[model samples]
Target: MAKKQSNYAYIGIAFSLLVFGIIFIPKIVDRVKVGDITRNESRSKKVLTNSDPVVADLMYLEINGVPKKVPPFSFVNQDGDVITNKDYEGKVYLVEFFFTTCGSICPRMNRNLVQIQNTFSDAEDFGVASFTINPEYDTQKVLKAYADNYRMTNPNWHLMTGDKEAIYALANIGFNIYAGENPNVEDGFEHSGNFALIDKNGFMRSRQDDFGNPKIFYKGIISEEEKEDEDGETQEISMLKADIAKLLKEDLVK
Candidate 1:
């Protein structure tokens, strides 16, 4: 009787151990799988950090192995002809928002854009487009004058103007920048002086501020201090120029 009791106790102990192992093993495996997934996601985020903040975010927005769609736009160019999204279907473009009478930073931005045009003059895939935030003031004639002032005669370079509301909507909502009437109403319409790089597929890949540096613009927060910087004269065009080159080079590889 005593031997039987001892045997039964041992059996019970073994069964308990087996049951515990069965319950805990799946949990352990699940934990390992979750850990692996977390590690891969972290690695991916790290890999996306590059010179262009917008491009860096684009890594997460890719669908079917390509960046997401770029919104369509319609505006009048320097020539007074209507330009639409269809015209830019197969071209990669550098886009900027500016006004002809912007005494602070518009000239510098145009100069930098001219430099970009010169850099990619031989590349048939690349072009430049500037949309006037003050469309009422920057009519086709005004944009034409502005383009000529910058010596921008490239058939591909388009200085554009359109309806006031349409231009404001594009600046604020489309490109995700600030553009509206100034509270003081003395400084004209307030809009970001940043250049956006759009790929051939029409995805906005990058944005660089007026200083021609990608580092100046953060995705979510555009600092008031940065706006002040745009108001000042600064010669830092090399950084933005390099970003354009990088984008072109990457496109070439694909």
Candidate 2:
């Protein structure tokens, strides 16, 4: 009787394995084929293809009925000034996470930001807050040199750095942007090439898509002139520029 029961148990285990193979093997193969199993890229980053229509009033990003607000933060900028969210209370700004030594996407992201900075050169209320993910290596002196290299002349464009844990929290938790270190990647770091738009009064803002969903963030990897990236993602820099202009015109709440 005991031998018979052991044989039955072995049979049951075999049957369960067969069922799992039939159900999950194909799905796993499909995901692998579609490049969804990548280790070098951020899974949280949304790819808003260029063809998506961008037409809607700038909407406040809300969660559970309350408008999302920029979380409080304090860091030293490239110029060695203590900057905080309060400094941008009445100003419209873009936020991004990048490291100075990044060779892949950081260059393109900063270049596009510089263009936007030039476009809004006259709007004193328009600004940019760039936080470094690798704060250990991106000191104030390093960020200052990088700012000069990129011609980031806008007085409001601050390349900031501080506590590594605090900066990571600001990127991953505070802003919901992806930025982390991974030794497997080329630069030993990975971050989303996306920018968050913040409106006056400290609320997060973005343009709605054709489907009436807030885009949430703009693609920072592609330039306005590029039309589309190599992966077929359309450049939203132009859209971003237009939206920034719109936000600049909004009246500050008293």
Candidate 3:
């Protein structure tokens, strides 16, 4: 009876092994074949072979069912070169309104922009179009000095200065990014501390807000390191960086 019990135990062990092999063997093989069995296995290999890499798409700002684009305007850059919307064709860039002599927010805004310039230091098709609100004082020379002081190394960065009215119109009417003069303000001028992202096609592009509306302009007043401001508005520098990367990648496919 003891010998028969030992035989029964052997059969039970073999039966369990067969059942395990039937149930789990294909899954183990599949995991190994897909490189999921090893923790150190390269994920890029699987992405390249089996799936499309994930990429985010930016939204086109629209008005009356038509996409808004960067308006056609020419202004002189820091290097005294004519820069227009055409100049930025086939490139991803940011647009901002600022003045060199600003005692308040311009410094912070440009500092944030400089951080972005450094982040995309290697991207050739990335650029910046900085329009000076105080064109009388911020000539090519002043803009050049400002660029130098900030170490603005991006070759495509253009600190522009032109007709004061034209600049104001471009700010207030064209891009709808507010810029105006105010004697009461410490800087003697007041402008929105925002940045607009433009795609290679000259269309102004941006990501949507939580409610699915285009954010339109990114907040340049807040630094990337800061998560939110005193008003509780979330910092968008990181979001801007991500969007810029997405636009640059879009250029790659075309």
Candidate 4:
């Protein structure tokens, strides 16, 4: 009877180690290989160019057939510092819009952003930024508290709040994420649930479909128009990271 109990204990220890390895091994291996993620993507080592067709409509204006560089933007970060496109020059960044009081998808979206931050927080060429739709409520002090809650102290990770119209304008015309307030909605607000990938030159990250063809994810979101998916957020964070990594590997750095 003692021998059987001892065997069970050993099996339990082995199961615990297996679970631990399953949970952490991939993240660790990914951190070690972070630099190589982009290189491992497409077979060609050729640098990305403006001429490359964008994967999303409404992300950029097309002069001919290529995605045009978005104009510079301005906002105030949690620390109350003004941030502009000039602030992100030569950096590959991810962007999103959320409100502090959101009780649903925003939390999950933030979790994904946190993962993105953790994955490449140390990469000089990479950064993450989020804009608050509720600027009136998400003051610098409120934003600071929210950032603290997330333990987001990296100088490169910016949680920003500014003029409500200004934030909405940038969301509508610049980043393509929708921002608006609707009384009918449970939270009296609506915004896109996407995490947009911006290239070093400020163009949204364009991607190809499974057959290596350009596929537009979305254009800018307008008021009274919202997209809902039964699958919730369909795009994978891994794919978004790979897109960012691909942009990092681009030759557009100044």
Q: List model 4 lDDT by residue over 91-188, tens digit each.
A: 88877889989887777677667767787877787877789999889899999998898777567778888788888998887766678999999889
Better of 2 and 4 by TM-score: 2
Q: Model 2, stretches more than 4 Å misplaced?
A: 1-56
TM-scores of the candidates are 0.61, 0.77, 0.77, 0.67
| Over 4 Å off, model 4 | 1-66, 210-235
Task: Compare candidates 1 and 3 on TM-score and give the better one.
Answer: 3
The 10-residue segment with the lowest total lDDT in model 2: 47-56
CA shift of 61, model 2, Å: 1.4
Superposed Cα deviation of residue 48, candidate 2 (Å)? 39
lDDT of 1 by residue, 56-105 (tens): 22221244565445578888899988888767766777667778888865
Cand. 3 Cα-lDDT = 0.90
Worst 10 residues of 4 by lDDT: 218-227
Error of 1 at 194 (Å): 1.4
lDDT tens readout by residue for model 3, 1-254: 99999999999999999999999999999888886777435786666645553434788899998999888899999999998888888889999999999988899999999999999999999999999999999999999999999999899999999999999999998999999999998989999999999988888889988899899999999896878888998889998999999988764223
For model 3, state the Cα shift of residue 252 in Å: 8.0
Task: Please write out the lDDT profile of model 2 over residues 1-254, one tens digit for every residue.
Answer: 99999999999999999999999999989987787776425544334323343323788788888889999999999999999999998899999999999999999999999999999999999999999999999999999999999999999889999999999999988888999999999989999999999988888889888999788899999998889988899999998998898888777875
Q: What is the lDDT of residue 245 in candidate 2?
A: 86
Q: Give the CA lDDT, 0 to 100, for residue 109 in model 3.
A: 93
lDDT of each: 0.67, 0.90, 0.90, 0.72
